[model samples]
Target chain A: MKGNEVLAEAAMRAGCRFFFGYPITPQTELAAYMAKKLPTIGGTFLQAESEIAAINMVYGAAAAGARVMTSSSSPGVSLKGEGVSYMAGADCPGVIVNVQRGGPGLGGIQPSQSDYFQATRALGHGDFYMPVFAPSTVQEMADLIYDAFDLADEYRTPTMILADGMIGQMMEPVLLPPERDLSTLPAKPWATSGSRMERKHNVINSLYLSPNKLEDTNYERFERYEQIKEKHQRQELMSCDDAQIVVVAFGAASRIARTAVRDARKKGIKAGLLRPITLWPFPTKAIDELCDGGASSFLSVELNMGQMVQDVRLAVNGRASVDFYGRTGGVLPTPEEVLQAIEKVAAGEPVVQSAEPGAVGSLLPHPKHRKSSYERGE
Target chain B: MADYNHELLCVLSGFGGQGLLFAGKIMANCGLIDGRQVSWMPSYGPEMRGGTANCSVSLSDDAIGTPFITKPTALIAMNQPSVEKFAASVQPGGAIVIDTTLAMNGAEGVELADGVEVAAFKATEIAEAEGLKGLANIICLGKLWSLTNFCEREVADAAITKCVPPKRRHLLEPNLRAFQLGIDA
Candidate 1:
């Protein structure tokens, strides 16, 4: 199955029965799959008029103690951000999927990892963080959706599956997990499913008018976030021991970085890869340990205009030289480009630690694979 | 036997409705049937059926690093524009199969990178002769199959069986016949 279809089926298997989403490129396949399959299994699938309405529907269903989900691509996700913040404020548990596309405003429909800042730092208007899983493969895409639901419920926060269009459109063999029993799920006593004279009626609201109560609630939420960071941060390290340089990437970009690391190794460049499976916790300790293990340089690669470079710079903290390479606006970086960047930085060339995105130093050279200007009739 | 450690990357390109994506999918499924890791990614926009389309398929014995292919080991160009655009990107010693009926160049006057092999054939004409007018994609796949032999012919047959939906089961026979004609050619 395609990755998006596998993800939809996996959501169903994980007992998510309420899906609300609008059609968007790259992620529309997931919504279409849900539309077709959910109804047959007695699940509710509704396509709202807009992305904002879709996410709000997710919020409503999640507050009523149902496993709910919504998905969209780049611009649509931006539309859903306000609803995301409201859900966070209400402390609702839901799953939101961002099959990201190239963007600042309706950027081309090709794959991109440009939403790193939005997803990990500020998905909504508030000061809150959710667990964000960046899946590199189709199987990981399916597996992460199941885990995201569990994490959301445990933390009472919205979790996001951050994938690019590449992973969503790609087809690969995936083993879907067995269907989960909704009956086996943990009880949600805080749900607004009516009191029925059992005890006190549960009030699910984000509006704590009193300033002191709001501050206390914010503190409690931060404590939970701290706990999640301490326990749930996930990363995959490849050949970091006895490495001279380490390459860090997540999601689609990591796949190319992985191949480049292997190529660098073949050329006797002692290169390793650190793939961040979870972007939320930032994997700061892992970077620290790599620095401690005598890694002299770090490279951060992404399919965006250097959005994640800031986080890596923060984590490395001048312990070692850090360089960045990115391909923005839907163009993907090749393994050769990654290798060239690592070689350039490793060969005693001063790393251009530029924070300015799309600068000549921060991007791999323009693709020679494209038709020349003359051939393009320019 | 092909070395399992050596990965194969191929791209199929043409008009959006030319079944290029399906051809790529079949190759990917063939890899899966042979117990190899595979990834197939299509490059099509919101308007899927009228514009230019292409897809990349990678097959490997180990985990595939990425689905994007900048320099493919092989390519099948179904139209002139596809050949003009992608011919320069084939890796050294790579193979490219071109459909001669639509790709007017026929491997002549086309400047390619070093050591690339170009196979030009009238695939659409061949398909039409067999009353398989829309099966040129499969014919091209067969010719490419003959050159690269990425997997056994039987494996390709099984892939076609798996790729064709149950509702379109009747298509399997004609596609197989078209594939056989290309192989024979």
Candidate 2:
């Protein structure tokens, strides 16, 4: 199954009957799949006029207690930010999928992890936190999206599937989970589904007119966030027990880093991989354990300009040296390139760091395997 | 000779309109039918808009790490540009199947690595001659399979049967015929 289609099918199996999204590359297949499958399954699939409108529709559907979702790429995600924040403030449970592409603004239509900070630190202007699940493989795409809906409802907050274009576009064999019985799903008692003239009206709103009331709401949300941080931190540790150099990466970067770690081990370099499946929790305890387990250094690999390195640095907290390696503007760093970076770190040499615009030429090494512009006839 | 049981990293490349991605999908499906780990990834976005298109298909007995294959163990090049671009990237002792009907000078200018096997056939011409139009991709797939034996012939046939969509069932016989033609060649 293609990753995007897998997500859509998984969402339906999770009882997500409402989908509101605008078309955006890398992720358009997700919405297209929903548009095709939703109606046949007695569900609602609406392509709103714009991303903002789509996310607002998701908010409305979520408020009505429907298992709802919306998906988009980077710029479109930016447009949906306000609604996401609104959903968080109103305690609306919904799933938002960002099939990330290169971007500061319309950067490119290639796989990228530059949105790490955007998803974890600042999805929107808010004093709120949302659980972000990053899936590296197509099977994870199915499993994580299925879990995202349940997590959103459990926390009464928006949950995101922060995937890159590679996972969105790639195809792998998957065993999709069987469909959920809609009647067996937990009831949302707080839903504003008609009072039936039997009780007081249920209202869903983000605007608390009183300052203290709004502050109290924010405090309550933070308590849930703290609970999530404590109990929901997810990570995968490979060969960390005896590793000297631990490479920290997630999503597609983790897949590449895993191969590099294998190569490093073959060369007797004592390397390991730590993949954080949950970006928000940041898996600090995992890093602390590795640091205490005698790991010498940590390398953060990403498809961006060193966004997640800050989180890794904070987690390490000066316990070990943390280095950065990445490629931005939609370029992917191959396993061989990552292996080179690992070898440099192992040898105590300074690998290339993230470059600012116009200074990239000086900081970046020419990848040996990449085709030259003239060779590509560009 | 390449070990068919080992990890097989295959690249199928051609113009966007060609069936290169479909061929890669077929290969991945073969691996799936055989209960092997497989991943198929395409060079997406602008490349699908009348530009050079390619897909990487990886099959292995163990868990596949990355879907992107920078250095492939096998290659099927359907055009001159694809041959020029990817012919040298095939791993040593690996194999390549080139469609000479579209490759300029029939892969003569391309410099392959040491110990690499080359099977150059005019697949498009053969397909047209056999009245199976637009099946050079499958023909090359057949030749590549013949050289590497990446999967059993029965497995490949079953994969083709599974991959052909319900609407395109009419073309299955022609596609099967094209595969047999390449095997015979």
Question: Against the true structure, what is each candidate's TM-score?
Answer: 0.93, 0.95
Would candidate 1 be rated incorrect, acceptable, medium or high by CAPRI criteria?
medium
Docking quality category of candidate 2 according to DockQ thresholds = high
Winning candidate number (DockQ): 2
Candidate 2 structure lDDT: 0.90
Interface RMSD of each: 0.8, 0.9
- Per-residue alpha-carbon lDDT of candidate 2 for residues B82-161, written as tens digits (9 for 90 to 100): 98889889988899998988885666877888889999989999889888889989999999998999999999999999
Q: Could you tell me the lDDT of residue A265 within candidate 2?
A: 96
Tell me the deviation in Å of residue B128 in model 1.
Answer: 2.1
Error at A266, model 2, angstroms: 1.0
Query: Candidate 1 clashing pairs?
Result: none
